[model samples]
Target: MTNFEKLLDEQLSTLCFKPNEIVEAAVVEVDRHKVLVDVGLHTTGELKITEFMVPPSVGDYIQVVVDELDDGEGNLKISHNEVMVKQQLDDVQSLVENKTTVDAKVVEIRKAGLIVNVGYLTGFMPKRQASIEYVEDFTSFLNQVFKVKILSHDQIHENLIVSHKQYLIDEIGGEIARLEAPVEVGGVYEGKVTGIAPFGLFVDIGSHSTVLLHITDINWDLTKAVIEDFKFGDILSLRAKSVVTSDNGSQRICMSLKHMDMSPWEKAKDDFVIGERFKATIYKIEEETGNLIVSINGIPGVVENKDVSWTRMTNSNLNNVFKRGQEIDVVVKGFENKMGFESIVLSHKGCQSNPWESINEKFKVGQVLDTVVTSVSEKMLFVKVEGDVEAIVHVREVDWINPFEAIKSISSGDNVRVKLMEIDSSERKVSASICRTTEDPYKGIVAGTKVLAKVESIRVNSVHLSVLRKGKKLEATLPARYVNTVSRWLPSGEIEVGCELNLEVSMIMSGILYLKPDNSERAQSSFGTGDNPFAEAIKAALKF
Candidate 1:
């Protein structure tokens, strides 16, 4: 060996390059397989070409790490990949300690999380921390770049975890703060609907904050309000009803769409006048109460069952008379407000002209007119007279003998002639007699006529008898005095049913026949047959 060569060997040994030590080297030669670099030592270090992210040009400075002092090829081996990895570790540690965000590229998708490359270091993002919304398919994130926050970083354990959801939350926090400051109760704002739930609609008021518009506050009618009426991204004008703070210190916003307009009841008095008639649409009928809820000029009003009609038979069921969407004439009676709610009382029957008005001028006693039977009850028959006027035919006035059988013989929609007997305007009642349309049988009977009658019923002081006159059965009351005078004519002192009696008409007044036994023999024998003794006795009894 030469003396200068021996000195070079000793100088190279003094450099003392150790394994895993980082050093800056100058590239001397770039080759296909390896890049030769000068580390300021007598011997040159060679780095694999694959380790250089961007292939280094000759004579360029590059960082390298010592892999071995000698690789048995008379050269020192170095690695560029190791130097890049060490630099990334230092950068990631700084980000974790400072809680900073950096951009990461998704490299691979795993069932539990995503593997991303942040600079030269690989990081793992758990499935739960992927995004603000639930991620079902992680592969959609492949090759996508997102801003991420470092959740943990441990270079020794090689644990580097990052979260994309944390980054989104931090970004939205600034917008939330800006929105919370200006939003106040009772303030109106324009917003867009973001989500729809069964209970309400979620609206995104400006500044990325979402508020709830409950179903009840959406419209005046809750039954007709439906979720399908609204859709996502619908713009609406809303009024903030309340701002509530939850137990978690989070603010909840309640908004309303109905408050955007004035209430109908607030202007009801000005819109409707008492006794004024208007056409109204029936919107709903309460099944339980049978009250009709109608809309008059878009204002809701109520018509109770009693106010539905003038007749008692029609008022019993207002639900069946009025149906949804049916338009009918109604008169506004009055308005009442209770418990922050207003109710308008209306009547459908009052909208028409009163039937009792000028009743005396239109009808007179003993006036016979054809009428249709509207309804029949046990005690009376309801008949419709002129112009929606209804008159009642009482059971007593229905027939002279069997009032119950007469009522049963008549039915609704049957045509019959009735005579007006009484008119009461204050009570709005008209009394009519069906039998009075014909001649009264008692009026035709003379005082001396003798007829046969059957005892029907015996009362405390009177005995009722049924008599046949002109093929019509007539009821006659025989007073106790008359019954006592004819006691020998009866089988016992008490009258019995179906017992025949010989009766003479003693007096007749007010459609009632007063009867006594044929006393012509006694009167003739006592008065000596002068000018018809029965007639004389009747004239004396009636105070002629």
Candidate 2:
């Protein structure tokens, strides 16, 4: 304690003070739990930290009501909130009658507004009434004080409605006219950033209302600098692009930061040429497509997913491989000007050496390569060879017969061993065969070899038969026109898969076999209808 406070305490030791008396006190010390104040009595008074609308600091003066001159514990007690309620009830009875204003300290945050302690009552201040400026986070205003006029009151419930915005308007009188200044297109002016949105930034340029500085207009290369580079209250020199006013007296102004200076495209024409290689930075990645917009020498360029790599596009997952501001090599395909020099078409894959140039040396006909299936169709399977070269596996090449059935085992993302059958370097086409990876099942079998076959797949004009030779199944087609078997064994009538058939190898060439239904007497007898006269006599005797 100071010597002056000590002397004052000794002199006031005999002073008389009663409970419920309002007294002005100076804050002596304060902490998180309690506040100590000198009430000009023999002893200092204690007030809870929660009692004050706003926490008071040392040396501040506040009016409080004395609750008890001395408690049994010898500590003087006071109530700041009670004193405020008393003053509020005494002076401000009705807002309609008094037309009065009071200063309140922000004590709590709510969804619609801030909760504060108005003298003699608790009040609410709507968020819009707090300020004309946008408040991104209301929590930042906690514990601040504001002078507000009561808009509505419920004295019985100790509830008061106040507005700080009205207070500001009353204080600023004619200065509000500055917002009505006219804004002309192409005129440069300073703007203050107020809020950030997904599509753009909201800034105030001293017009009737806040304007939008669109994301596209914020930078020459949209991805070069991210939206996070800016913050609220940042001052920017911008040019007014367009202004529009709504029927409801609302105004919207569009501004640009890029137009404040000359575009880089103007100088790119002299420094760069078409069909040349140059280094570029990834500007942005399309969220829906795997397309890239790269910047070269500060000039924008487009790189589609097809030009990104030799691999085919399945999804917009290129963002996982590339990032904004990353440096990459690209080929300047061409430039086009629409209104202005919009962008130059670029190809990142073109900058690399083509793998097809050495196709003959790297692979040969019938060379087996590990392949992954890309997609499956009824008649063909698309696959990637060595994870790069795109190749097709026709169903006919997958198996000698029943090729469609073999296709069901292969699907997208499945690994299969296939041999390259044909490679057309000029067409950039590759034909592969999945069945040829294994040995031919009919290696030693010659033409005219009779074998037992099963109907594998039925067709309109013919039926595919599976012939087993040397414990391996080979495919053979039996033509309906060539079938000369017994009437009961006709393959064209109602042949089903798994039905056994007596077939003769009529011809064999180029790994394909032609079969004719057997017509031999032994073959016919084995499949013909059966009847006996002895069975008929036995049935006649039983009927009598």
Candidate 3:
């Protein structure tokens, strides 16, 4: 070596360069495999082409990090990737301290988090911090850029954690604050349904502010409502019913869809007049209240079970009379509209002609007509007379003898002649008598009149007998005294049903005949004892 060359080498060695030190270097030579850069050291530093993201041309200055002081071939080795990574870490640290955000691209997806590229260094975003909502598919965000805030940083450990949800909240927080002022109670706004739950629906009004629409506030008839009627992503006009502060000190809005529309009963008074009839369709029958929900001109009305029919129904099963989609005429009884609630009261029977209104015209006292027995009770017999009006035949008015026994003889659907004994139009009551159709047999019978009666039944103390007189049967009661008198002549044990006997009518009261045996001694004295003419004449008169 010459003296001047040796002097330049000694001068370059005085630059003071060490390994792992980042310094600015100027590109001196560029080749396909390596880029030679001058770091002002004893020798030029060489960087592999793979290390530089963008190829560096000659005379271009770039940041580089010293990886080794010398290679085995006496060359200085540096890395461009390591230098870029160090610069990015320093920038990210500054951003974290200042609470600033930066754009990051999702490069890879992992089970626990997403691998994102922030400038030169890779960052990690956990699944929970990815977005405000739950992320189902992380691959959808691959290659997508999002502004993120640094949640944590570990430069020594190379742990860079970022949150995309925090960035979204900060970005939209200003708009939400502006909306809170105008969102007062009773205000109306358009919102989109974001989620559906069993209790209610979640809707986003504006600026990503979510509110709840409770199930009760959705409609007036919750019994007939279902959650399936609504769906997610549906746009609905909602009314702000209330504002509540949550435990987290955040404002929550309670909305309503029903309040946005006028109530059905708001104009009910003008539309429904009492006693006026309107055709309506039965829509639903409430099992809880036993009320028939009918729609008249698209307005819902209720017809209680009591108002379903004029006749008292069996078990109040209005479902037997009214059904879904059935069209029937109903009369408006009344309506109420108060405090944002509306209801219309209706009656189905009121629209029909009242059978009691013309009851007197169709039936009169002492009118005898054929009727069909509809139903039988212990003390009364229900019969359907002319005009389909029901008249009750009480047990007392059923027969001249035992009224209860007469009820057993007739059954439902049996034909019988009845006389209308009483009619009350105001009370809507009609009473008939089955025995009054014939003439009274005791009208002309006088005391001491001899008659022959058949023993109907024999009791311990008395005997019940029936006599045929003038084609009418008359029931007579023989008292114990009279029965003993008869027992003297004929053994009481021998008295059987359908046995004939001679008796004289003693007294008649309250439609009952009192009888005694014809054993009067004065009658035997009038005609001498044997084969007495009076006795013969009495027997002849009785046709015994």
Please give the clash total of every predicted structure, in order. 0, 2, 0
lDDT of 2 by residue, 477-516 (tens): 8877864332235423446687787677888755557888
Candidate 2 achieves a global lDDT of 0.73
Each prediction's TM-score versus the true structure: 0.37, 0.41, 0.39
Best by TM-score: 2
Q: Is candidate 2 or candidate 3 better by lDDT?
A: 3
Q: Where in model 1 is the C-alpha error above 4 Å?
A: 1-278, 281-299, 304-326, 331-334, 347-350, 354-358, 424-427, 444-449, 454-466, 475-501, 504-544
lDDT of candidate model 3 versus the reference = 0.74
lDDT of all predictions, in order shown?
0.74, 0.73, 0.74
Q: Roughly what TM-score does model 1 have, to 2 decimal places?
A: 0.37
Q: What residue pairs are clashing in model 2? A: 84-120, 85-120
Model 1, residue 526: what's the lDDT?
34
Regions of candidate 2 where Cα sits further than 4 Å from its true position? 1-49, 53-187, 193-202, 212-235, 241-254, 288-290, 304-315, 333-342, 349-544
Residue-level lDDT tens digits of model 3 in 88-182: 77687688977698888899999999999777777999987787544578889999999999988876778689988768656644222235454
